[model samples]
Target: MRKIKKICFYVLLGVIGIPSYAQDYSISLLPFSTDNYDEFSPAYYRGDIVFCSNQKSTIFIDYTDEKENLPPLNMYRVEEVERNVWGKAELFSKQFKSNANEGPATFNSTGSEIYFTRNNNNKKKIGNFIDKNNRLGIYYSKFNRRSNEWSEPTPFKYNNPAYNFAHPSLSEDENYLYFVSDMEGGYGGTDLYVCKLENGNWGAPQNLGPNINTTGNEYFPFIHSTGRLYFSSDEHGSIGRLDIFYSEKVNVEWHKPIHMDAPINSRYNDFGLIIDAFKKSGMFCSDRQRTSDDIYAFTPLYPMFENSQRQEENDYCYVLYEDGAENPDPSLFEYEWTFGDGNKARGLEVEHCFNGPGDYTLELNVIDKLTGEVSYTQAIYPLKIEDIAQVYINAPDTVEVGQEVVFDGRKTNITDFDIYRYYWDFGDGRKTRGIEATHFYTIRGNYIVQLGVVSREDKEGNSEKRGVYKNIVVVGSLKERGRRTSD
Candidate 1:
């Protein structure tokens, strides 16, 4: 790590050249994936996952829908065998069965309660939905500890046979409920809506505004513990078909939605994303590999960051106030800073900027206006300038044609990172590896220099490589001097 002066109050995190926030995601289709079956909408529950799938159930033989000759979507539970591994998936419950379709779901923090999607006419005993459901509806159910089964499902008070209202997601505190609906007065196909749990019942629904809804469609709402909302939309845009997007509500308004990057998204329909509170790993639904949607587990190579400000590049600047000198007579002699790099300043306190990494003998002389130049030097300090702890390369940002520029990594400072080798890419079809290398440009132009630092593997056989870059400008002659880079 690069150490900042106590005055500056800046600390360098143990990262390479990367300062901007990003997540490198790796994904894998779960072992439960089947070619003929469809599975999606994974929800964390009871230290495991409950998802909607149309796969045949082992407990209920011949569970296929007789009308469609295909299995209808049903809730299934999968237990995690270990990290990033899951065992077989089975029917979520026998008591929570419905005659119509059952889709996306969300569970309370304790996993004892659930709010899920089902056909509004699931019972089909009332109103105009006697034979078929006019649209979807949200229902709540709880685990019955006495019978060791799920209790009877209760319809949401706002459930109307006129429009669709499904994909329920609950807030961490269960104080707010987010869901999708096309009930009317919406932007387009489907819009996200939320209701506050005032007293003991849910309040009126509030639209998420035009920023979240579009003329297209948005569904699969998942409210993370951080209050950021994740959902799928096609009107906003698409990488494949329906892509996943997330937005954070500031104050009362929601920020513009941000599209997720691929493998989380793909050239196929991707939606129903559920990630952990740490944002390190999670599972999502995508149809990139097969014709049917399948749940895939994803993990990030590095931790994700939010609300992180951009880091300023260090310029190797420092101030020398006391040169570790004994008390000297201020009336007799004044302090003069003689930096061995051909720079000199006279003061008790002065600032200096080093060009690059090297060893320099810093001299402190005492002189007075009343007296002539002091014959004796007050302090002789050995100042060795080293680069900040990174895959640091010491090179001039500007050079001349045919000028031998020294590329040095000897001063690369990193205590925890055990570097095995240093690799260089001059961006001119040339590459080399060492602590130091010398190169020259044939023609005057701009070239990007890359320094690759490789680390030794750990006991787990895991290693990483970090590359840092520098922009070098080459000039034809000395008369056309290049601009000096920041010190």
Candidate 2:
């Protein structure tokens, strides 16, 4: 028998500052998630998702006793309806479906292998009635590419016939497996454990230690690609029954977990977090609505720079340029456009472009279509406009060869830029850098004069360069040109 070890976990209730790279995520409940029954524990398998739900199952008869209305949890797969939205749900594996519970599964990198939690179906009868042996345990299955089906589940090595072991999450490399178990040698009602896969065999399960496991249950251990572990714990300070928390691995050890906070978490059971590869967006399960647990997708609200920060190189603001010809469209109701630069317009549709790139307050004063009351709403809109250096040459197009032609580069205009260097290439093996230059063409012919300007503003090498070329016809002296024309 394993020795039971108990350790105390001190919960920290204060909120910590979020990291700069961390995102302010917005949550939206998936459309397919129902209101009555429970649907939770979403895991990504390739592009689709596999989750646990207690929805109506044809194979299993609803168990009515202490638990009513809620059916046995089973694994179901939902395809993408359009982008993040999902389609109808269906049984993930027909062969693995049983009268017992099945749920909370994960797939290996290639998605060729899967591990799931299900109640032990093999039971013993005590009397005239049958014992279903409802203890949950992890199960394994393999996919056959040719047949397009999943193999019958086989009990995992760590699964026990008595104690419960469920909620399996795999590392990206599939070298370490994390799960929730209530077996002996845990700190609380349930604790998280990890087992290493060595030489094609899983080693002995090791407890995640006191930093993560607590006197209360810790469920749904998901290891992100960044080695950060996410789980739900009733032991830590939570807004409600259970809240999602994540801890990063430092110095080869797990640190104290931190609560995910509001929006992602709420005053209800929120758990089962699954992040994408980049860790920018993903989905999770929450019962914050007071209904059953439903799945929600989250994405970060990025700064104004959707692509690059260089203002002039990118389009900072889009000019809607609407005349409000279409009325009562609802979308155009209370139409007003206030370009942050103090320029305002009123109509069903209007357009405004920022004068230059800088921080501005774009206020939209919309009048109530029916009430005629005005409300000004403003948001911080950062605009950047590229100030391009331009060179305009003002010189005579035709000049006598012996005449002194003055080339001026002072006409170059660089908005919000200081011209540091001006270059002139006379196309006559002569080049000079200055605002103005005098050149005498001794030979009569068509000469292409080029002007190049360079402007530098800061030490960071934020510079702009622009060039212009002009064709000049330098005729010979009047008498020499007349002699050539008469011949």
Candidate 3:
């Protein structure tokens, strides 16, 4: 049983591609000063990066000793000054705090609501009472653009008490919240959970399931504006420490996650990912730098798949019929037949047929010995001939006065009858010729429209004739006094 499971696992890896397990993505590390203890958890907000760092100097001791126990991490922002280069880092509002370990921040699409992880001595005491191992929990704050400051941070409260939650990401619409938790009932050490926001409150948290979370920790999930998810995982195979990976939602379900390759991942730990929706560039945290962990900038190159190919060809043949009977002979009165398959036949009407059922772009290249260059090309869908007398008239059977109506006389089983001509009697003194004829009623009355067709034969032995009749009614115009009375 174990061997069979192992075989299935390997087959899955093969289908997704083995190189993805160890591929390294290209990245540029953020320049670091020697003063910082660590720098990580870079999140995107309005074309800038909001991250955490411990760049304390002798003159600036930011955190208290109790806060230092966890880590002296403070949130910072780096704006893009040029194409690839980032401007110098600056501290966010004091409401974010320079005194505790504050990091891993995400902003709503409008950059108004901020969610970040902050561990204070007071929160640590509560965490310790709940679980001696609980290190930190995520917090939320809102930025007031008018005041240019953030509101006081508040601990995010979820239903789950046994789990340690951090690294919160709000969906683009702020309707869903995704976070990482080292909670029980998970497939691995830590897993990603998403909770829907209902009536402005966070609802139940759902595990991202085995497709994303594994026996190892999965953290730092950043959902791009396009709905693709990026996170770090050690459970799935990685090049080194927890490497950054991405998964895209193709439809309702999430597709298999892909690893960002070599240069983006190394023997050192890498996490925290962010990307701008419009610019297509973003930043992540990596310990690949020489001494301490630092944030890096990267642009993702999406792969493309090949498209399926198709080919089609068409062929046509013809047969001639006269008096509802097959006829043979080429030299007769002038006749032209079009197969509706880009092929034509000339003589006194030849029965031209298509190779198959499809839209055939055809042209009737007719050469009148008298009126040269008489050509007619039309697009047609030639249905299979089922019976001989299946004639259809396209016009309505009833119409009002002054309305022009058309009558179409069509035959099914008689193939070689193309050289035939149509005769239409509008029953109102109007007569016309051709397969289709149009006429307008001059007076109000019920009239029986008639269409007659005669097929030309080569030897003039006999002629096949078919006709159909339909009734139409035309209404007279009302007088002005009667129209007003009706209204």
Candidate 4:
């Protein structure tokens, strides 16, 4: 009982290291993440999220906690209305939501079988009792879609009342079950363990080894469809508390786990990570607000590329054109290239130089010379051509009306070319010429500001005109900050 009492405090440890890689994703609170109570460990199935909660305000308002004054964590499901919006959460099932604890569930690919955590209790026989306290154990339930009801739960074959076994994650093929437990000879308080599902029977559980099981707790294991193992740990270097980490299987071995950097791994307890089937986005649990646990969702803004296999870049800009066809002969395809810098070439491979610095559109037209079929592709290739002038403008995107605003171009890159002229268009019928200019807006509206630069040192009438545009918003002025004095 003393060891079980310490389980709740396992999430409070905060000393750890941060991941070296940068986080290229954005995260926000799920709309249903309530401030009144705790919600965590979200498992996505189809369009719904099956999660754990201990709050009384949930749809299961009638579910009275049987574990003294402490609310028993129970499983609930919510329908995702949109990307970040979710409908009200409901008890997974009235009958399944027992007085005892039940939560942290996972479903198979078919969604017909579920593995969940529950207290060890058997109404029929004393032989099932590993000890008198009835510690945690794993349970399985089958869903009869035809009847729309879950079958009676059966205890996992390896569940022992003397120890704790929870947080199950199934492999893609459902051939292996990964879970967290405090079984004997583990690396720490609780370590991740896995058991194989062979011939309708679960084999002996095996520890995931030292690479994963640290001297601290590791829990909430999730296996992404891409075969990545994601879990939370307090021992591994973390931003704080329990940060999420993931490791990929390479050469039949698990690599060292990589920290999931923020805004995913904040200075808070973050765990229960499950990526969407598409692997583009997913959800996680965090107690960052210091109020109550909440669920957060994240999505990547760019394509995820392997860090070790990134293409090396040279000093000069270059483009590669591929046939992009299956097993086509190079001689059968003709290439037409447009550098978008007033340069064009026709060949399978050709290099061109730009005379100025700006964003350039490179187009490649591939023609099947044999069938006369043609296809084309284009991509924007930015170039900072050496000895060319580049202009950068800095201005507040929005400001109060009647406020004076400054537009500065001191950071502009004019490394090689000599600037002949600088022109500014304030979009309100006002024009000026200078490297830096200031203006005041009296009306509340949106204005487009344009900067045009003419640069060429040696030749007259050979100056190149480069223009940049930005939108500025003017709003009504705000009142001064409120001040209070002690009475």
Candidate 5:
């Protein structure tokens, strides 16, 4: 008689076997402008952060209105030499003008197309508006890398006559274009809309739903690579006048927006957030220091997944036995197992097994020394043996009469036991076949549904039946009684 060694593996729950470190993030402010009231909308594209600032110009005269004290803001580009060190800021003279206020910039993936908003006084002369000075509209300019010059800016064609359009952001795939607009037919002030960029033409815009926009204003919309949206909103639990808020799409619906807290946001205004997909470093403009608004970079230290930090322990063990033999190989071969937890082990004919029950990929690589060649790897999955095969039946527990209802049955355990046939007794003299069977109950009453499965092979060559039962209550109504049957 062979001695059967039953190695019981205890599957542990919530055990951290391997330690993981949090990803470190750092930021460096670019030396662009020391003058007060400057710098906003810092965007990273092709390894450079392009921003807007109101720095003192050496050649041009002061364009600020001495009475109102509004300075001219020109766009600038700052290149990063190393990881933390930023190169000197250079004014984009060829692209920006010295006339009116220019700011709130966005760039494409390749840094070829640049879109920005400019307060066009000339547009006021073309059309009269309530707030003439605040009549800002978006403009588009293409950058030619070969010549290192930007083309003349042109007004975007889709600007509505009712409201101003600003703060444009392109989707990572560049298939959809999102921008903030105070146009009509919106839920509230300055609603965000996305339009499909089809064949180089912008299509009609659609509102981003009520979750993102409210009766109050929502602006500076930035979409991250991970599909999380970041924007500024004063209406949604903000710390101050305008605070940055972020929300992600779950199950095709946007969840309730949450405020970005403390260091990244302050009591003062924080807007214009930008993040790189690769490094996950975020940049935004904040007036937290009580000085002028400066561009600040922050590394988001939050875990990527909500369940990423929580480790699930496996303590249940699976016992592996040969198909017909009780005691097989004691020292005839080697053992190699992959635990699927980013770990692996190798030994020569060992009896020790794993300590947990989970989806593990195990492989046994054997060697033949006489032939000087390796044998085929044998793979086996040790499953928990249960007496009753737990089957989940997915169907309505209650249904109206004459309604076609679907019954689904899923069986677990008994891997080699093939279900040869299925018999569903609908308790109304009607029977059906197949794992997922459909039946219509005629006349309203309480009925018991039974699913019978037959095993393909048995010792006597006869099929063995496995039964599953479910109780369904049927309601009788005028509409349900009048319903016609397909048969």
Candidate 6:
């Protein structure tokens, strides 16, 4: 990863102050990126990646883009060599309008069906708008298992020759189709839109509304399996020309989109992002070089839940109720409950928060109402309150990458269990031993700090051991994480 980062861009240095907001993300340009050709809008196909490129294909014969002076964009496939590496790319398919512009595709779970964008060239004409020149629209193709061939591409049912509708992204369940279009009544040159597939037919297209679509173009939407909608937009006040933003659906409405942090979003045009369900790794497009758009892959140093609300606060408060009732018309008697703590209350039920972890004897007594004195003891209970019997890790959950962090294990509480040694795994292939230890991380990312305790061996040659794990986010230097448009 360090090598990949160096290959991608220079590491930031010399900045002094802290970043206003920072995230642990690392990005590297895809090895398949070419010098002059444009590559963007990557879609995952099985283990390989299918992306659109303007590089000439099949004997250097292809149509040229009407405006860009570049060759027509065609879908290309590249097998993943390994993590952070890719093989040479080849023409994705010939069944689709390969000679015309086509790419930015989405595949169903089985890869048998595909939804993509291409120049309008279907035979079926709809309504009076039929004079199409280069307007793009959504297209679909199905694989024939027996013939081992792809069916001829067909335009979407809602496709119209009068407007452009491209960059189709299908949901994982195949129940929703998201795309970009310049159709009338949209917020900008292009806006994110979706259509539900129900009863074997695609429903009317619905705009994602102002929260996502702005006066600036919003396009290249990728719906992740986690119900998150990620797309690129020029309207959300980005750090660059265009930036990728993601919005989670709250209830039935889409929440306001969040701008992706730096590195994932550079100052140049950055958009068209697709991430896996776990969000640990994925790819996006960026033109930071000012030459042509290129595909780049990104991964998180720390896993998710970094800033989410911590788990329900450790609960120590408990409720206690008297078990038996004193009969014989005890209207003249009152109840008095004394907890193990130095506190007493008069009631049938009592709720208390203990001061510390220990064992004590609690007593319930019947008091004489007139004399205000204890009559007799009704219940005697042995109550034991102890901290969770496990190895405990005490440290900050978030810290700078190179800042030394201290881990304390003296708080560990186990009844009758003696610890002989304390061990630490820094989650970065580093380990040490101590009841208290200090460690620092080299690069920015999230690491699981582990603490292990070993008990002394008894006469029987048996010992008890326990280990615990906690997540700690190691942020990068402010200079490195600072948002920027260029080097």
Put down candidate 1 lDDT per residue, 1-487, tens digits, no spaces: 0000100111222222212323447888898877777788899998899998767665454444443455556799899999767799988887666555676789999998999887765543223221233467899999978988887889898988877778899999999999988778988767889999999999999999998988777878999987778998865656556779987664356767877876676656678899988766888987776577788989764411222222225576778877467666777777888888999898878999988778988888887658667646878889887655666678888887667789998766667778887777776644556789887665678997777776787899876666677788988655434433422
Best by lDDT: 6
Cand. 2 Cα-lDDT: 0.70
Single out the weakest 10-residue window by summed lDDT for candidate 5. Answer: 1-10
| Decoy 2 TM-score against native | 0.57
Candidate 3 residues 1-487, lDDT tens each? 0111111111111112224332223567676423235777777678777777666523555334342333355778878787776778887656776444576778887788898875533333211222233345778888878988888877787624445677888888888889987767888777899989888788888999888988777878988766678898765777665678987553244656877666676656767777666635667776555576777777643221122111111234446433332332223224455555567676544677655445544333434446545533222234453332333344675665545566666532335465366666666543556677666664667987666556675696676655556577776434533675888
Model 1: per-residue Cα lDDT at residue 171: 95
* Number of the top-ranking candidate, with TM-score as the measure: 1
Q: Write the per-residue lDDT of candidate 2 for residues 31-150, one digit (tens) a residue.
A: 768888778889998788888877886745545223243445668889997787678899887776665567789889999999987767533222111122456679899999999988
What is the lDDT for 34 in model 6? 83
Stretches off by above 4 angstroms in model 6 are 1-23, 121-133, 303-487
Alpha-carbon runs more than 4 Å astray in model 1 = 1-23, 57-69, 81-85, 123-133, 303-386, 390-487
| Model 5 misplacement above 4 A | 1-30, 33-35, 122-134, 145-147, 301-487
Clashes of 6: 3
Pick by lDDT: 1 or 5, better one: 1
Per-model root-mean-square deviation over C-alphas: 16.8, 27.3, 22.4, 22.2, 23.7, 14.5
Inter-residue clash pairs, candidate 4: 17-237, 17-238
The candidates, ranked best first by lDDT, are 6, 1, 4, 2, 5, 3
Q: Report every candidate's CA lDDT.
A: 0.73, 0.70, 0.61, 0.71, 0.62, 0.74
Give the distance in Å from residue 234's predicted Cα in candidate 1 to where it truly belongs.
Answer: 1.5
TM-score for candidate 6: 0.61
Total clashes in model 5, counting residue pairs 3 or more apart in sequence or in different chains: 10
Pairs that collide, model 2: 312-385, 312-386
lDDT of 6 by residue, 277-354 (tens): 666689988877767788888886542222322222245676878756665346798788898788898877888887
Question: Across residues 1-487, which tens digit of lDDT does each residue of candidate 4 receive?
Answer: 1112323326455356555544557888887777766788898666688888766634434434333334566788899787566789888876566655676888898778899887775332222222436677899999888999999999899888678888899887898899999888998988998999879899999898888989988988998766678998887777787889987654345667877767788776788899876667888988887777888889864321122121111234564554452333578776767787777776756877565445767766676777765654433344444422356567888987556689986656555566666677777644556789877665568987777666654456454556666688887666311221221
Which residue runs does candidate 2 get wrong by more than 4 Å?
1-23, 59-66, 122-133, 304-487
Query: What clash count goes with each model?
Result: 2, 2, 10, 2, 10, 3
